[model samples]
Target: MASNNTASALEKEQIFGLAEKEMEYRVELFNKLTHTCFNKCIEKKYKESELNMSENSCIDRCVSKYWQVTNLVGQLLGTNRPPV
Candidate 1:
């Protein structure tokens, strides 16, 4: 019983570690995406504090393309599982 408990504890620890790693990776990806898309889509720096129509449309396309590529790569790699 003690050995079983130890094994379960180890498994839980491993799962938690993996979850943490995934969260970290997702955060990194989000940051990169934000930087890349903002640079690519926002051509003009406006002082109005809100995105213009063109900027909003560009950002929409940028995010859509990003996810499309990510999903395509995931499918090609046979790891087509949806993110948690």
Candidate 2:
């Protein structure tokens, strides 16, 4: 029926809208994380083409700690469903 079709179309549109929002949120979060870790772990000057061992370790630790804190806050808020 036309009504059913209209409802189905609306439902799909909403689902797609939600998916788009999730993607945007993820991209924004990634950008923030990258900026934070790079600033904290790497020097302001670009002295090397590749990260040194210490720089690599610092980034790893920074990301690990970021996620740990994220998880903790998520748990505290009861929103700690596994990542989508």
Q: Which candidate is the best by lDDT?
A: 2
Runs of candidate 1 with Cα error greater than 4 angstroms are: 81-84
Could you give me the TM-score of model 1 versus the true structure? 0.85
Per-residue lDDT over 1-84 for candidate 1, one digit per residue giving the tens place of the 0 to 100 score:
999999999999999999998898788778877987999988665667888898899999998888788777778778854232
The C-alpha TM-scores of every prediction are 0.85, 0.90
RMSD of 2: 2.4
Separately for all candidates shown, the number of backbone clashes (residues 3 or more apart, or on different chains) is: 0, 0
Clashing pairs in 2: none
**Which run of 10 residues does model 2 get worst, by summed lDDT?**
75-84
Candidate 1 global CA lDDT score:
0.82
Displacement of residue 80 (Cα, Å) in model 1 is 2.9
